[model samples]
Target: MARSTYVSEFHFSREVRRLSGESPAALRRRIMLERAAWRLQRGEAVATVAADEGWSSAEVFSRAFRRSFGIPPSRVGAEFRLPAPNGLHFHPPHSLWLDGNTASADIPALMIAHDIADTGYLIGRAAELSNTQWRQPLSPNQVVLDWDGPESSVAAVLCGTVWAKEVWLASIEGRDFPSRAATDPASVDARSLAVHHDDIGAHWSAMVATMTADGRLADTVIDALCDPPESFQLYGIVAHVLTYAAHRRELVRALLSRLDVPTRPGDPLDWMRGN
Candidate 1:
């Protein structure tokens, strides 16, 4: 028989504080997961989430769920099998959704538990994916969204800022101007996706190192952080990455939506509102 550990009450409250520091993009991702948890709590079947949530297909939800939670929906419930010891789960009122544990019979507790687990899983996954040296570039799906022109350098700058803003919005909460400019607009090819994803990690690492080593915010926030702004802890770096990833993912959806490609519903304000 599998032994399940009850998440202690003290741990729950403490974890919430850690989660509270997430940037705007992370918060929105959490809100979306909360809705997913609520839907599951209401007994909605995963197969029906597509029709119910306006997604083009259940597969999209599954991908988002995995990306958000680190585990597939089929493996989410209690009594569901777990891989080794690192699977994810969700409990309740947690903002994010996903968790891992032995079988569970408590629906509300499970919902919140899973949310916490999923949040941690997503953060850890990001770190792991970023640290690897795999040569796989960004997904080809993003190629069509590349904008080009003589002013394309300026546009790339803006896009890089958008990427950095997502990092700040999701984790640091304070702005950091860490970004890289793409010179050749034509270089923003299908490979750009890979480059962009790598840049997200590299840029954020640079921001963290710069802030810690020199106590300087990125150039993007030089004006705002001129007064020696408060320093964010290491966890803050993780939060920024999470928020950044969520925002970029949504941006991908938005661009695709404009092109008439199906997209997942996104709520930037949920993060912007600081919820």
Candidate 2:
């Protein structure tokens, strides 16, 4: 890295400290430990994470973890984040995020959590059917969002559940609208459904976390692309999403049941208990 930047190693270290308030090695080490903590929180074996993070041994990793977090790795809980001066922290599913703000209070994550997971489950179940079964109109001539056209088939409803978030995320980021070319129910598969769900889920989690941390949900966003140029508060956007995402998820659950796919009731209690 130093050579690529045309600097000596010593000069590189100095510049890094000047810009980030930490040496390069320290930042890397801290980030590694953050990743280890996250993996542990997700139930990875201590020895496994230790090996992957370059710890000399599990004992050594535990010692370092306790030093950094003031708790033994065995008792690791909701927080995996460390005191990162640069606000850099490990984000799941292969990513890092910079979060300088701390929440005064948390926005409950449960509301949308079930919606996303249930949608993914429905998508997987839908994938088990033949194309004919998938495209068969479960609710012939039914409509969800008029702009989204018909979602009368199992495949269409399941795909719509995931696509809703992708489109909203685009709007939030002021990006061009996502293409509707993949709207064919028979063509959409479980893998694509899960990919879109998980990807948008990550972005959604990060956005909610940031807004909750900064208490910025009341902030307004104006849509320049709308012909009439609409405006929305951040919290209102979230509320709107939860409202419709819930609708689509319920549609998926009902449709999946109609096809005799065994699904737990759309109850959060059952979902939380892994029922």
Candidate 3:
């Protein structure tokens, strides 16, 4: 059937709307226009860009481009670029630029710790949600086996984040996986989750301190998760932890939005750039 119906079936339509303040159709149009603008900036012909983006004609694409970016497609490759509207501005991740000069030895760990703390902050915002909001099913049609409601989804993701870090730490230290937080969302509350977050933060800090003292970031070999257990440098484990933590944080944010809780876009770049 309809695109909206498909999105609603997966329980993501409302979450997408709440996060971006736009319906799916509007968001799709915006993305199409943004891609068209990028193509034009790279000196592609307006007609080609328009057709590739599924616009009816060059004239139609030009009008939408002007409306969205305050300039026609033809002007995009000119000497100066037009400024995007406030909500439309794109921000790249600052953490990607961290390197030998800009970041210290402990920067990777610090960045991951910052994300964990930020996830906790977002979860704390849900403390005031009504009981109905907490208990509401994420999708009206489908039942998630382990997670039945918004709160449990958040709890499960939070638990997953901690477990992921613990797994990495064990690999790095050449030990078995330590005890992890409860994965069942129904068994934990916001207060208990906060304590879990704090404990995870402390464990991360200790691991970073040890790594810093030994200067083994590059030399230590980790038994990474793979078929036959391949060996990888310690830095690989750090990168994996960072990526996994970011993904889980976003899952919790999406669940919160689906519950009708207002959440600002929690991009780590926003936190890093002090926005």
Candidate 4:
């Protein structure tokens, strides 16, 4: 498959500021919980919570709930934890971190919470680089981009890939995943990074130039980018880049967690701030 130009270079220092004070674990939980809540609010089964929240399994989520809230999820009546139609507003303190946002006075729990918080900070920092202007070179771990060479900074490379995907989506005017046609089957075929750099560099540069002309994207454009069309709009493309940054951030967090990397305590609200 050809490489996609979805994201670009990032300066870690600058990018972190834009996403300051938020943790990935918190954000992930928040998005998932809200999704599940919405489903529940609409008379959906509690199992829908796992599906909407992106839990690996209902058992896993139930365990986590019991550990965090001191009550079996089954016993918690729907009335005590009603889902907001729009979304769940994570309360303060609990909203700060995701690893363990509880206020229980357990020392061991606090230590675990600290660990989750620390790791979350690192993940958030890495994401910030992609979201901001960091001129650092790309690392192999970063997602590959069709436009840039393998030597590009890790942050930039990931951003470029996200940007390209958005461009592809916009070019076809598609919704995101789960939508019947969110992805363009034809566009999924990405070239090897080397082949992509050699073949698509010029096209990538042209797109960047167009984006440069419009700096500070407008909202409509961002919406278009996150959800692309067959044609291009400068603002829309930029929005796609930002949205990709956010999405990639989530992917990175999940990867890190699976790899057993340490994380900081965080709340769902922290990660939801950007979108």
| Winner by TM-score | 2
In terms of lDDT, the best-performing candidate is: 2
Model 1 — which ten-residue stretch has the worst lDDT? 128-137
Error of 3 at 178 (Å): 2.8
Question: Alpha-carbon error at 264 in model 1, in Å?
Answer: 5.9
| Total clashes for model 1 | 34
Q: How would you order the candidates by TM-score, starting with the best?
A: 2, 3, 1, 4
Q: CA lDDT of 200 in candidate 3?
A: 67
Runs of candidate 1 with Cα error greater than 4 angstroms are 1-179, 183-187, 199-225, 263-275
Instruction: Candidate 3: give the clashing pairs.
Output: none
Candidate 4 lDDT, tens digit per residue, 1-275?
01143333334323433464323345445445544544544565666667556778888877766664456555554433323323335442234223443554444223323323333344344443322223343234444344433423433433344345445443433445322122222222222222333333334344444444555223233333344443545455545544554444454445445445444424334533532
User: By descending lDDT, how would the candidates be arranged?
Assistant: 2, 3, 1, 4
Question: By how many angstroms RMSD does model 2 differ from the true structure?
Answer: 14.4
Candidate 3 structure quality by residue, lDDT tens digits, 62-132: 89888877877888843222332225422221111111434554576668667776867865865656545
Which 10 consecutive residues of model 2 have the lowest summed lDDT? 99-108
Model 3 root mean square deviation, Cα atoms: 15.3
For residue 116, give model 2's deviation from the true position in Å.
1.6
Alpha carbon lDDT of residue 90, candidate 2?
Answer: 81
